[model samples]
Every structure is written in structure tokens, then in C-alpha cells.
Target chain A: MAVYTQVSAEALAGLLSGYDLGDALSFKGIAEGVQNSNYLLETSRGRFILTLYEHLVDHAALPWFLALTTHFADAGLPVPRPVRDRQGEALQTLLGRPAAIIEFVSGVSVSTPTPAQAQAAGAALGRLHGSAPGFGKARENDLGQPHWPAMAARCLEGAAAIDPQLPALIEAGLRATRDWPAGLPTTEVHTDLFPDNVLMLGDTVTGLIDFYFAATDLVAYDYAVTHAAWCFSADGRDHDPALASALAAGHAGTRGLSADEIAALPQLGVGAALRFTLTRTHDWLNTPADALVTRKDPMAFARRLAWYLKATPNMVLGR
Target chain B: MAVYTQVSAEALAGLLSGYDLGDALSFKGIAEGVQNSNYLLETSRGRFILTLYEHLVDHAALPWFLALTTHFADAGLPVPRPVRDRQGEALQTLLGRPAAIIEFVSGVSVSTPTPAQAQAAGAALGRLHGSAPGFGKARENDLGQPHWPAMAARCLEGAAAIDPQLPALIEAGLRATRDWPAGLPTTEVHTDLFPDNVLMLGDTVTGLIDFYFAATDLVAYDYAVTHAAWCFSADGRDHDPALASALAAGHAGTRGLSADEIAALPQLGVGAALRFTLTRTHDWLNTPADALVTRKDPMAFARRLAWYLKATPNMVLGR
Candidate 1:
């Protein structure tokens, strides 16, 4: 979400007059994302997050975001609810940016979540997978958009400066899997269920944030992403095993990971890690500093690629 | 660079009133960049590119880009001279965007560069290294941004989804070189010298563009980036053995490649690839779609890592 250029609040409020969120008390962008503009807002009775749809988000598919969150909420999941306009529409135009408001959750993002916490997250993620099937949104996930491998190759070019072996590693990964997983359950998964996205109150997981990358993907893929997030250290190196059993237990409490999912966890985890690194590399290569967005280093994630492999061995060992 | 929600050309033109780049015949953004809003413009004088100063671009270092290009042109290098205004101001304000105009080189970036091409590019890059030391500017490169590693770790998390082993490999690389090679020549280098930034006519390299990331860095690091870019295949694996030599030839045509540089090439190449893949991954995790920017994959570059390690044993084998 490019923010180098500022977006005005008054202009956004004017366009949102068509919504059911009641008269806007105020709306101003809260700095957080690189793919979309997030606004903290106050309404007649509550505080909410107003988002300006950027590129990765499809305005036409917005009903899915609103509906999925609502569906999960109705299913007794702790998730935000989309505030609709008086006109009965959840999606609307604001400051010419595609807009929507969701109730905000206040809690610390579990940056260094405990193993049990990870297990719980894993469990919750499993539940999310279970609930996603019920979501009206049943679209295929855009794993690597427009051109995936080509973009990776491009990034490989940039990172090669740091490590001469980088290009071959990239190519090996590309050759390892050129096509998508043949068959898997597709559901609305919170694709980016990193520790930072999950809010925590002391030891209990509170709520999740940053669902801008959520989409219908393989449930195991979500698990893979979670595993990488939960198990890695700040330096992107492997740590003690994540709360895998607890996560599985929690997930089993709601749903269950099949034999296939267990087998595919390692590959999926690598895929998630690769995806984020490539994307970040893109930002590093292009984003203007004035964009007010911080560019993340792709190497941190690259280092974790080793962690994923180690986890895979552990995964099989546990099995 | 962030293209604002509302871009006003008139506002930009007002700032450039003092500078003359001929009448702005037309301005159409060429949406393929990481740091600036680049437009292909047609003026009475000829074709030119108008670039808005973007994120991380230190406007204070404009002298490097301007003076270097001017120096090269004066030294018989086919280079683009920045167009200055009546007041000899090369930069002007446009619609709140800081911009400059440069002569456009006529050529397309090569999709496939041969070993010979790689050598030429290498040599030119070496010459760039030679020239970097003499650039009268006194500025330091800001590659030590806090967000770089975080972004890389984020991508590694994603990479795990594709191949679990990847995380482990990356971790090893990071730990192995916590403290980079010492006693290396460091200077201002074209940090963003990706293939797209290099223009080639037939087999001859024409010019280099986009110097926003150009700053003081490890000399070997620059060569690593150049090799990673010039030596790989679409699959992200396989490089030419003679490639480094070709670059050496290009540089040696005027300057020369040191034995230290040649010995360090394989290792530096690996580093360069890692940097890009990780950054690309980070962007993938965060990129918004409206930017039409695509996320890159690190697996492709991950393969390059091992390849470089293997190539190292043989780098001096036949040579």
C-alpha cells in the first residue's frame, strides 16, 4: 500500500456518507500496510478500521472479505464484523479509494509467541480452515500472481549481490515445483496468520489483524504459513519446535489435519516463506522512501528457508 | 514511488517552470519501477524520461547521478545528460513530485544475455566500480535500514510454504556470514543494477539507468549483483563459467578486475541473489495490487545459492 502520497480524511468521509456505519465521527489513515491504506475511525458508538482498497484487493470481491469475517463471527469465532452502510451495502467508495469499515481489536500482536501459543494459533488456523468452507467466498487463491516464477527470478537477480549461490537456489526451488498442488481443499484461509497478525492478551490469543492477504487457498498452505511464522526466530533462523501438538490439538478440537495435510506441511511452509520474501524483495527494489512505507529485507526470510527444512524433518519424525 | 491518489501535472509543471526540458509534449507513466514514477515523454528535442524522486532516494546525492552521467558522457561513455532548466537546475517540483529529465537510450533490455554479454556487463560494472571512487560526492549508502532483515524474515516465512528445506538453507547462509568478508574494497555501486536497468543494443551493452540505490557498498557485492543478474537462466539456475571473465574483459577493456574480485565473485554472487529474493519475498507478503507490481519467488534464487557454492569449487578450476 503506497502511502508516499497522502490521502485526505475529509474527502474520504464525504464519499462514505452512503454507508450504514452511521455518520463518520472522523477518519484518518493509520500507518501499517504497504498494500492498502488503513484508517482508524470513530462512529456513533464504536471505533473501527476503515480500509482503502489498494491493488491486491479486488473491490468487486469485497463482499467476500465482509462476508467471511461475518460468517466466522456468526460461527462463534472471534473475528471483526464489517459495518455496512444504511443502504445495506458493506462496500462503498471513499475518497475514491475502495472502502470498508470493520470493528477494531485492541491487543498486542504476539511477536514471540510461546509454543503453546503457536499450537493454539495452529488450532485456531485449523478452525479457520474448517469455517472457510462455510464462507460464501469460494474463489481459487492467486498463489503467485500475473507471473510468479518470473518475478522470483527477477528477485534472485537482486539478492545475488549478497550471496553468489542465491541464483541457483532460486532456480532449484522453481524447478522443485512448477505447478500448483494438484488437489486440495480450497477455503477462505487467513493466508498471513503470522504471530504479528494474531493479537494476544497475556497468554490467551485475542484476535487477528492484517487479513488483507486472506483468500481461498489450501488449508495446509495456511498451516504451512503459520508454521514458518510461529517457529522462526527474529533472525529468520530455526528455533525450538513450535507448539505443533497443541496447535494440532486445538485444531482437532475444531477440525482435523488429514494425512495428506501432514505430509504436505513442509512444502507448503516453504511456499509461504518464498512468497513473502519475493514480495518484499520487490518492495525493496522499487518503493520510494517518501512512500512512508518501510521496506522489509528479503534475506531475513531467505535465512528461514533453512528452518522450514528442519521443521520438515521434525514433522516427519513426529509422524 | 507512490503515485498519489490524485496526480496533478499542472502542479508539477509549475515547479519546473524555471527549468527547461522543452515543452512537455506528453507524459505517460511507465509503470515498471521500485522507486520512482517513470514516464516516457516526447519533447520537441527528442525522447526523454521523466522520473519523480522516490522512496529512499536521497535527493542530496543528486550530484552523484548527475555528475557521474555527465562525467561519463564527457569521457566518451554513451550516457544521458540530465536536462537542466534556465537556471541550471536539474531538479524541479511537479505536482508535489520532485522530478528530473534524462535523455532516453534507445534499446530494449535483453531477455537472454550470453556469457559474452555477461562479461561485457561485468567489465562495465568493474569500470563503474573504478568510477565510483572518483565521484566527488561525499555520501554513505544507507543499506543498513532496520526493516531490511524483518522483511527478509517475513519472506522466509512465506518461502516455507513452497519448500520447507528452503528456510534451513537460508538460515545456514545467514549464520555462516554474520560478519561479512573483511578487507574488501567498498565504494558507491549501482546497488539496483538489475537487468531491466541495463539497456543493450544487439550484443552490445548500451547504458545503465536508475541509480537511486547507488551508494557506497562492498565492491564485491556489486559484482555479485551483476553476476547474479547476468549469469542465470529463466529457471533461476545454471550460469556461464565464462560469464565472470566476460565482465572482467568489459571492465579490463579500460580498467581491470583484481584477483581478489575474481576470487570473491562466486561468494558475492550468492550474496546478491539472496538480497533480491528476500526483498522480493517481503514485497509479495505486502504488495497491493493497484500498483500492478508482482511478487517474486525466492525458491528460484534459493537454487542459485547451492549452485554458487558448487560453482565456487570450480570457479578457478579451469580458468
Candidate 2:
């Protein structure tokens, strides 16, 4: 439910003059992506999504994001293909903001995805990981372990204002995962694969969106993030073992995991939980009360971290 | 941009079970109407608008609004025909709010409508006025002249906080229109026909939407509202005489206005200005700072009223 910027019809007409997509028949701001203002645009050519990148996304990293999706789409992966203007550029400026028109993918994003949907999402993610390695660009994960200490410290500073127990809980979680195993396999990972980002038609995954968070990170950690996302209830405390097993199996079928990767799943899962917890805590504290975007509750991830603290590798691996 | 209630997938699926419109392929909340939650719903059937009525609309008035559109649509008027469910009811409950699935009308709404578009809108509005007399159900205009005094008082009470000159200006408007002309011809009127509500494909008017403000009022008053809307600049201060003349010509071409109606146009235009000014003033002052809906600038209508206070019938009618 976000449309931070309002685009006028006259401005849209001026922008469309550079594109070959014909005149816009209908243009509407849609509540889709959280990081950008998205509009469901219908032109004489077809239906397309016009996105104006918001402040949360760095302009320098946009080319990488566009290229990554273009790479996936060119490889016949289920992703939104960026539509280029007559000048052969996918990105342009509209209303003083970087904007792009991407092909509209038809599928409903499920909030409470079933086990079958979880499996399909896992398989799609594994395929993405395999395909993305061929792309030559490398982006260091900006929200990874190295940045966690600073984020955690910021969260601790505002902890007492948000909740009395937040600081101690975050400190304990940080201490537990400070010595995570190193030298794991690295690849391009969609650090955010929450159910909202994956589009599904019944049991099939039709599209994967919001690649703005894609970065070079541990492959198993991507699976860990997905597991944390899909295999938990809304409360974040209750884990669904069936969904987790199915997701893991789906990933194995596409891109099999190594024994070391399996062994490190629990620690990476804890790390994944902390990464989200810290970012969400920072957002929860920083976002203005009058902002259009609703901040996710950080406690949900904290609850997941609490569960991971007591769980063994067998719990996530279903050994 | 309003999607006050977030509809979950499970709830959407439940709602669709009662309709023949196959599973939802894509559902995106649209930033269109301010008073309701609108989603551009694409199902296996086709495109439709799924609207959940907000608290601002009275629940009892739902049927009258639906039936009125249904009547006009059946008569081949350019309106969004309501799609009835399996029970043959257009209005139903979804996400604990009065919801309806309306046929999606193609074409884009213009912010700054061209003179030709203004003419087309005038002609279409005339047709609607002619066709709506047989709608059987009659709803009194809730924001009519009788309600103006209380609204004026409310605005005056809060005027100093908004602006120093507001109270004096409003008091003058209230005193000037206190004894408005009586015995005007009344009929079903679309009171809120702003440029954004009328869809146009090139120069043709494709659809007129957001009939939630429709009621039985002076037929000339509806035209007055349209004149103020279509003839004003974005700043709501400057009036385009050519556009106003064209709009008047277009309306007269369809259903010629009576001599009395033409004579009352200026006073009605002033009333139209006051009606909107009061409502916008109320919303501007009352809407919470954290509310998702942006309060429109009341000063726009204030400026319009100031213009109307000085204009003669010859200026509006081009006699």
C-alpha cells in the first residue's frame, strides 16, 4: 500500500514519447514492491509495469539489478524482462526519478504459501542461483555479517525506547553467531526471497521479483533465508517441519547441497534471522510515523532467532 | 493512493469462490479513489475492479449507488457496470467491508483535460442526466444547501488555524448564499465529476466513475460542478473561457438547458464551490497526520469560490 510519488498524465505522455510501446491506455499506481513506486501500465503494445525507483534503492546499483534480471530473462528464466526505449536503454529518468518499464508477469503472490508452493519456490530459487553465476558482475552483500555489528549497535541504542528486553536479546544472539563457519560456497543470491517476492500460479512459480537485494553471498545462506521465510507461521515462532523438508528437497533436486553446507544450515539460519532482525529493527525505529510504507515488526525475526538458538542442524535439515 | 484494508490471499480466494470469475491471476491495489480501497483484479475471466467500500460511505446507500449505475449502464451509458455474484447481488461482503467487482473500463483519465475532451464529457454527462430520471430510487443530496450553514460554522471554527483570512471569506460566502434561489428543477446528479473520474480515449469519453457522490439535486448544479472542474487550471484559480463555452455547448447539444436553469448557473456554481470547499476544508483539518489518504488543499476551492464570487452569468454561459 505505497505510492510515494505521483506521476501526472502529461509527464507520462512526455516520457512515453521516447518508447515504442505505443500510448498508455491506462496507467495506475499499484501496491506491489516496497522499495519503489510501481504502476500497472497498459499500452497499445501490452501490459507493463512502470517502476520509479525510490530513495531506499541506490541509483548506482540499478544497472546491476536490471542486468541481472535481463540475464535471467534472456536465459528463459521466469522473470520480468526489462523493456527498452527506442535508444536501447532500459533505464531512463521520469519525474526526476530513475524509471523503467518491465514486462508484467501474471501470477498472484500467496501470503500463506502451501507446502507445494514452498517446493516450487525453492526449485525456482535454486535455478536462479545456477543461472546467475554466469553474469560477470559481483556485488558484496551490504547487509551481511560484516555490517551486522554496526546495525546491531544502532538497534541497541534505540532498544529501550522500542522494548525493554530488545538489547539483551540482540546481544545474546550476536554472541551466539559471532563465530559462524567461513569459506562457504558463494554465488549471486536473492537475499530477500520472502513469499511476497515470488509469484505463483497454483503450485507453479511463475516469477521472481524485487532483485534489488541480489548480491554475492553464501548460497546456503540464501536457502537459509528462504527457509526462514517460507517454513514459518506468521508468529515466526512456530516452524512447519513439512514445509521445511519439502523446500530442502526441492532445492536438492535442482542444486544439491554439500555435506558441509548441510552441517552449517542451523548457524546460517541463525545468521539469516539476525540480519533481518537488525534491519527491521533499524527500519522500525527510523521510519517516520507518517510514512506511507508500513514497517515490518522486528520482533517476528527476533522470535525466529530465539527458536534457532535452541534448535540443532537436524531441525532445519530434517535429518 | 488508498488501500486502507489489506486483503489476504485466503480471504480473496474465499470471496472468489462465490463468483464465477476464475482464480485471480494478478491482484494489485490501485491508487485511484480516495474514499475506498480499489484493486485492479485480473482473473481467468478478465480484468475487473474490486472495490471495498470504506467507512466514509454509508452502508445503506450502497444498493442505491449500485442500482443507479446498473440502470445507466443498461441504457448504454458509459459507466462501469457492476458484476453480480452467483447470488445475483452486485454488493457483497469481503474483508468485513462492502465490496463489489465492477467491469474494468478501459481508457485513461486526464488531469488536464483538453477542450475536446471537456466537450465529450459535457455530452456524456447530459446523456447521464437524461437517462437517470427513470432510476426509481431517489437519494437526497447529503451535502446540499441545508447542510451548508453547519459546514460553514465548522470551517469558520477552525479557519484561523488554517489561515487568517479564511473565516472572513467563509462568513461572506455563507451570508451571500444564505437566500439561494428556490424552486429549481431537481434530478439525479453526479455531484463529483472531477476530471480524474472521467476516462477518455483520445477525445472520446469512455467512462464516468466514482458515483458515490451522486444524489438528487438541481440538474443545473451538476453542470455547475462540472464547469468548475473542467474549466479550472491546476492551481484552481484561473478559468479557461474557451473550455467553459465548449462544455456549455456540448451539454446544450444533448439536453438543452431551460432559461431558468441557465439564469441560475452562476449561483449554482458558487454553491458547488462552497460544497467542495467545506468538505475539503473539513478533510484538510480532520484527517490524521499519519493517515494514508492525502488531504486535498482546501485553498483550491477557496480560490475557485473567489473566482465565482466575481463572475457573471454571461461569463459562464457565454451569452
Candidate 3:
């Protein structure tokens, strides 16, 4: 949540010159998304989010991401579509960085979501999976299980320093998530459907956002990611069974889960936990001390991994 | 430039319950305003800025600041007024910090301001001085000339570390601004009227904001602060003669500076430069490395002080 690139008023005016968005009225940097520099840009026409892709984002894959979001938005899902210019370009360059103006989806992202909100968010994720059957593009899940060992290796030394037991926990996580359950239902999945990514009004989901980490993956695994994010407390030490049950039921109600998918919840949950734990560990070690970014604690997800290791399929499903 | 406090959605909802602003449609942490946590809050009624006072702010002086802004806003000068709750209390507490909702003024703060923009900004400052006559509340200029020695002492070692010449320059600055000009006009001044603090729409001043540093001080001193901020380059090395002349003329056109105030511009300019230099230096040395803040370069204002020490009234007033 930082504004890495500073866009000047003149530059913004120059950028908007290509489009029919009209003259700039108010522009303020938004501290929301982690990976990109976001600015809440308001013009004579309307309010929109102007995102400047930071160094971390792969420029080559940006078009695919935008297309996926467009697909979701076209399917009547609560997703922000990249606004195209008069030149029919959704992707443009600004301040020497790839930039795009996105539709401003109005809603609040709940930090501590209630059971009803969790259910709504879960339904939104299921709807996203159901909406993207016609999207022809496919991006590999680079952060999938096969990549765990390399991520673990890079994090081993730093993880050991944070806690002596952390290194062992990570190693066990890698071992526990080894066997892949073949022949599962696959779809265009929002690989990172955390609660924070869902925007809600009361008990209804208004916007499902931050689709940058999206790819064609197992629908059940996407459900597992959402489950891991919402059902547990911030520190990942406490579980809310009610929230978990609500979330699973909401997803199941929208898109019926197979018996195999339901039974595989515990294993998928382990994979999700380990995936986050590794990323957080890498970020904690590598992110500079002075960067205007918050480093999520690696231990939070590490604790979640531990919980998932001991959990049964019935326990994870809240049955 | 950072969100120090994270207000949960529930906490925000609870805070909004006391107001007639209706339900929060969107809330995002704004990456602006260094001293406080700012959020762009949009409700069913309208958009507003929710500010949470950080540790740096004096809680006691908050009401006075709010009153001062309300005073300016009431005069229809494009200043945002504090939106009071149903209890008629502007100052409320949320997440264990003093909080208030302010009207969202629509305009972009220019990074590289044009000469016309500088004049408009100056005219706005002059209007602020003209507008307030019966404002009973008074705030001492704690960051005035008297505070320079202590600020310099605290920054001595660090200043020397930044440059061997910095300490000497700071010492010389204190001596140059020693003899305060007497019998000058005093008014409630926006003591920190930097270019970033002034919002504009096509060279017309739309919002004169960030009045936390407002105090009863020499009107010329406030003019000097705005001059030092706008009429020079960001590094404070290259002075813009056209911009300086335009700014002085703009202020003079509105309020008509006395001969004494005009002559005192050079000295007041030096004082203004030093005040900012010392504060920036203190922040540079003291702010933690991990802070989600952009620490401004102290040398920028120090260069302005150096130029001001050598400048004449004619050069400053663009005669």
C-alpha cells in the first residue's frame, strides 16, 4: 500500500488528453494496492483509479490481466474494467510506466469481516469462476506447489532467524503439500481471493478487486485460498468456525463442489497456507526498510500452515 | 504520506452512525498529508476526507485548528470546514485517536506550478488574511524564530554529518533573522502555505488547505513563506523572477502590503527558509527508517536561505 511513482498534474493532463475523460479536477495517490502505485483520479467526466504499474509487475503479462478483468466485468461480475482511450487502448504509458484508468467500484473492504460478509465474498469468488469460461487466455500459476521448494530455499536462512522452529515448519509444509490430487475441476480462478480483495456494502458484495494474481487453476483451490484468508483471525492463531461454514456454504451454493473437491479441502488449505507463508517470508526478508510499504508478518501464515496440517477435511469444510 | 492508524470497517460504521453523512460507500487510505492519517471517505451523501491525528499532533491544539479552518471556510474562501457530528462536535475519537471528517475540496495540487498559479495561490493567502477579523482563538507560532536555536541544537550533529557546511549555514541563518521587524501588521496566517498546500484549477485557487501550522503572525512573514515555497525550484536553488513578481503582485493587489512589510520581505524570507530547513532537518534525522513517509531534503530550504541572505527587497518583490 504505497505510491512509488509520483505523477505530476501536467503529466496527468497530458495522459488524459488521449481520452475523453476531460480535464483533471482532483488527483490524490491512493494507499490501497500493494503491487502498483494507485491514484484516485477525478476529472470533469467521472472518478476513476489510475494505476501505474510498479517494477514488480510483469509488463508482458499486464494485457492478459486486463483482459481477464474485462471478461469478468463483461459477465456482470462486480469487477473493474480498464477504460479504453479514444484510440481504443486500455493500456497506455505515463511517466515512463505502464498505466491504465480503471472503473471506480465503490465499496468498503472490511478488515474484520462478519459471517454474512464472508459469505457474500465467497459467493463473489464463485461467480468469478463461473463467469470466465469463455476467456480464451491462460496464465500458468507460477506460484503453485512446484515452485515451493525454491521459495522455501530462498526463505530458509531468514526464516531460521525469525524463529528456529520456522525453518522446520516451512520444510514440513513443503513435504505436506507434495502429492497433487490429479483430475480436479479447473477454471479461471482468482488465485488470491482474500477477504481484503472483496469490497462489500452491508452483506452484499459490490466489488471483487485486485485480480492481478489471477490464473487458470483449480476452483477448489481458489475456494481454499478464500477460506484460509477469512476463516482465521489476523494473526492466524484463532479460527472462526461460523465464518468458515458460511464462506464454504456460500461458495457451494453458487457453484456445486464435487465430492473429491470437498474431501480435498484440508490438502488444498495446506497448499494455500504454505503459498502465503513463503511469499510473506520472501517479502519480509527482501523489502527495503525504507520503502513506503507494510511488510506482512511471515509468522501469521506460518501459524495458519500449522493449523491446516492438523485439520481434517470435515474440520476444514466446517461439517 | 502514510496511514498510521488502520480503522476497521465496523469502527468506521460506528463513527458514521453519529453523523448524517449516510453509509460509507467507499473508504481508502490516502497517501497524502504527512502529520496525520488521511482517508478518502465517500458516503451516500458526498465525499469527505477523514483525518486521524497522529502522535505528532498536539491533541489540545486540535480544537483551535478546527475552529480556525471553520472560520476560513465560513467566509467562503474555498477552505474545507470540519463536518461536525449530530452532537455538534467536530472533534471525535476513533481507534483511540482524535478524528474528524472534512469537506473534500476538488482540485489538483501542482508539482511544478506556473507563474499564474503562484499568483493565484498568493491571492488566496492574502484573501485568508483579509477574511479573518473576529477569530477570537489564537495559536502561538511555536515554530517561529524563537524555536530555531533548540531546533538547530537538536539537528547540529546530524546537520554536520549531512554536510560540514550545513551547521555553519544554519548558525548564520539564526543570526540573520535575529532582529525581528517591529510594528508590522499581524493576522491569522497560514504559516505553511507551500505549493502542495494550495490546490488549483487552471491557475485559479480552488482550495487553500493544510492549516495545521496556522497561527497569529506577521502577514508579511506568511507572504514570505508562500514566496519561498513557490517562486523557486523544488531544490530551492533556481529563483523564478517572473513567478516571484507575480506572487508579490497578487498578494499586493489583494491586501496592499505596507512599505515596512515590503522592506521586511527579505528578512522574513530568510526566517521562512530557516524555519522549514530546521523542521525538515529534524524530521530527516529523527524519522525512523521503516516509516511509511517521504522525508523531504533539508538542503532544499537551506539553499533558499542562502539565496535569501544575499537578496534585496527589489529582487524579492520583483522590482
Best by TM-score: 2
Q: What ranges in model 1 sit over 4 Å off?
A: A1-9, A12-16, A20-28, A144-147, A179-181, A310-313, A316-319, B1-319
Spell out the clash pairs found in candidate 3: none
Model 2, CA-based lDDT: 0.86
The whole-model lDDT of each prediction reads 0.63, 0.86, 0.88
Expressed as tens digits, the lDDT of each residue in B128-212 for candidate 1 is: 7777676656446555222345655666777677678777766655553455666778776787776667766545667777777
lDDT of 2 by residue, B142-257 (tens): 99878899988876788768777667667766776787877877888999999899988888888999999999988888999999888988667788888888888889888757
TM-score of each: 0.47, 0.98, 0.97
Can you tell me which runs of candidate 2 are displaced by over 4 Å?
none
Using lDDT as the measure, the top candidate is: 3
Report the CAPRI category for model 1.
incorrect
Per-residue lDDT of B34 in model 1? 56
Runs with alpha carbons beyond 4 Å of true place in candidate 3: none
Positional deviation of A305 in candidate 1, in angstroms? 2.0
Share of native interface contacts recovered by each model:
0.03, 0.73, 0.89
Lowest-scoring 10 consecutive residues by lDDT in candidate 1 chain B? B1-10
Q: What does candidate 2 score on TM? A: 0.98
Best of the two (1, 3) by TM-score: 3
Clashing pairs in 2: none
